[model samples]
Structure formats: structure tokens, C-alpha cells
Target: MAQTLQEILLAPNRRPKVVEDVTKLVDSEVSDKSGVSGLAVKSGYALIKKINSSFVSDAVDSMLDNFVGRMEPYYASYKASGTGSFTEHLTANSSDVADALLGVTDDRAAGSRRDSVKKVYAKLRPQAKKHVEEALPRLGALVEEHAAAVNTG
Candidate 1:
């Protein structure tokens, strides 16, 4: 009608139907330790910020080349435009083409893609020096900024 444990701390004689209990002594202090999930959340946020920065920097890296490549035709248009139909007259007669190409117009509305591009060119002095020293620009080998940096590190 009863059983006995191999209780090292108790005697078998009267270890009662409702036996004595053992309890732990808690210090009642809260730990300042953080969990793995919190760390993961922080790291995930950090990674998102890093990814966003790189996306913009990748854009900045191409800013000069792409912008000049775009505006070049307009600058070339003054040379290229003669006079003719709607499209032809549009390129020649529009004052905004020169103004926009020179970064004097609604570039602010375009978020200063023009200024950002100009800064890219302004920052190229060192690379320009290196190419001039290396290539010794001849007649036909005139260095376009876009073509100059090609195949370089």
C-alpha cells in the first residue's frame, strides 16, 4: 500500500504519505541578459541599412558616366542641330535643353542628378592624371571620360 524512494537524505522509517519537500533558494534577482532573437533583430536591421546604402552607392558609382552619357547628346545637338521639322526644331530652339544640360534648370526637381554627376567628374582629377601620363593622348585617341576609365580597376 506504500512505496519507498532511494532517498539519500531521508530515513525510510516515517517518510510520510505526503512526504517532505525540497525547495530551491532563489535570489529573486532579474538577469540583464539578452536573448538570441533580440540579437537577430538588431543584425537584421543593420543588414537592411547596409543593403540600402550599397544600392545608393552603386548608383553614385555610375552617376557621372551615366549622366554625361545622357546630356552629351544635347551638348552635341548644338553641333548636330541644323533645322527642319517638329523634332529637329525642338532640339535646336528649346533654350531649356542648354539650361538643363548645364544644370541650371529643373535639376532640383530631378533631385540634383546633374550636380551629383558633376561632382563625379570633379573627383576624377587623379584618374585623369594617371591616364594622361600613361596614354599620352594623340589625335584620334582623344580620351572621353567614359571611355578613359574603361578596363581600369
Candidate 2:
């Protein structure tokens, strides 16, 4: 049977490598995009790498937790006030949201950041999800192989 992600992640020895591989995969997927949205993806990749390198435990989970927590309120407020999809809401308020999230000061920089966020929400979100899902089986296999090698040697 194929091991679930949580099953692999729960193994103390395997968790860090799994997290590293997943984060790297996500970063790669985001970085692989083209056009103006690539700017946001690159920024996001940098932030993810920074978060991942900052701790000994599961940094990706921590980042996700924080991101979700922060976003929930924004999403709720948007939902309460608007009728469109979240992407549409985000695109309409990208500059304000980007400024709030990133603390960008320069108007030009904020505009760029807003564009990046809009691109991510509007276009790249599904691709990012699919990329991660597609990578999981390969990552699990690598983990199994590593475990076997470690056990044998």
C-alpha cells in the first residue's frame, strides 16, 4: 500500500527530509512560471526558503499555519462584503492587500507585488496544487529508498 503523506511525515527521522523535499518542490513549481506573475512567485519562493531555513522542525507547516491564519480574516471580510470569487476580490484589492501583507512602501514596488499576488491567486493556484500533488508519490518513493539504504548500511 502507498503510504499517506501524514504517515511519512509522522516518522521522526523522515519528517525533515519530507518537508525539505516538499518545500523545494513547491519553490521549484512557483519559480517555473513565466511573465509578470513570476515576480510574485519568486518573492514567495524566497519567503518560503527563508521560513524553511529558519527552524529545525516543520517550517513549511508553520508557514502554512501562519498564512492561513492571516488569510482567513481577509477572506472572511471579502466574503462578507463581496459576491465574486476570492481571486476576483483579491485582484480588485491587490494593492491594499499586498501592502498590508508585505509592508511594501514604494508605490511601484507595491504595484509589482500586487500584480504578483493577483497572478498567483488568479492563475497559478491550481497549477501549484497540481504540481505538489504530482510530486508526492515520487517524494515518498525517494524517502522509502533512503530508509532502506539507511537500514541496510
Candidate 3:
């Protein structure tokens, strides 16, 4: 029988590892300059690429904050069930993880912060979707590995 996404998500022992690996992979792939540049070019804002890159990076960080925040309760519930390492790791490195996920490097333009905020509103969803899609395959594989281990052991 195939496990559902919810089943995978709620699996106490496996979920943390799966989430950690998936998030890392997504962060690495989405934050790649080549990938962001491609997206900026597609947006027809290639000339303002630096600004757009900062906006995308900030947007992704915000998105990860929301995502990780939502997962906090789950983390708490599983805290004694072997998720302590992940919980501690997340607590210690969330900012770094967010930065990695966002791919932020240079500071946003001081004067254009307001404009970048406005642009990020328009770009957040699509960029989040792209990152999620990029991470899906690896996430699936992790889940499968967990399921296989559970079944055999």
C-alpha cells in the first residue's frame, strides 16, 4: 500500500529527517544564482536583476519562516519521539537555514526597500511553487526510504 503525504508527514521518526533533507535540498537548488537569474529573466526584469534577486531571496525567507513556523507544533508533539536533534538543530540554525533557503547574499538597496516589498508580494507564490517543485522528487525519495526502513525493521 502506498503511503499518503499526510502519513509521511505525520510519521514521528521519519518526518524530521525527511523535512530537514528536503528543506536543505530545496534551499540549495532554489537559491542557486543561475536559477534565480533565469526566473528574473523570465520576469522581464533582467536589468534589475540584482534587486529582483534580493526580492526573491527575501520572499523565500519569509515563506520558509511561515512553513517552519507551521511545522513547529508537529515538532513539539514529536519532541520525545526522537525529534530532539531536529528540534534543537532547527532552533539553533533557523536563521541560517532561512538565509540558505532564500539565497540572499548582498543587502537589498536601501532606497528601494519599499519597492522591493511591493514586488515580492507579486512574486512570492510563483517562486515558492518553483522551489517546492524542485524539491518534490528528493522529498518523495526520502519518504520512500523511511517507509522501506519502517516496513523492514
For every model shown, what is its TM-score relative to the native structure? Answer: 0.19, 0.37, 0.38
Show the lowest summed lDDT stretch of 10 residues, model 2: 101-110
| Winner by TM-score between candidate 3 and candidate 2 | 3
Model 3 agreement with the true structure over 11-68: per-residue lDDT tens digits: 5665556556655554455455255545663453333445555544444343433444
Top candidate when judged by lDDT against the true structure: 2
By TM-score: ranked, best first? 3, 2, 1
Model 1 residue 110 CA deviation in Å: 22
Candidate 2 per-residue lDDT over residues 1-77, each given as its tens digit: 32232333435666566567656655555667666656655666565445445432343544433333434454566
Q: lDDT (0-100) at residue 143 of candidate 3?
A: 44
lDDT score for candidate 3 against the true structure: 0.46
Candidate 1: stretches off by over 4 Å: 1-50, 78-153
RMSD of 2: 13.3
What overall lDDT goes with each candidate model? 0.30, 0.47, 0.46
- What does candidate 1's lDDT look like per residue over 1-153, in tens digits? 111111211223422211211100000100111355334333433453464544333432334233334344543553355443323433343444334333421242246444543343344322333322222222112222212223241
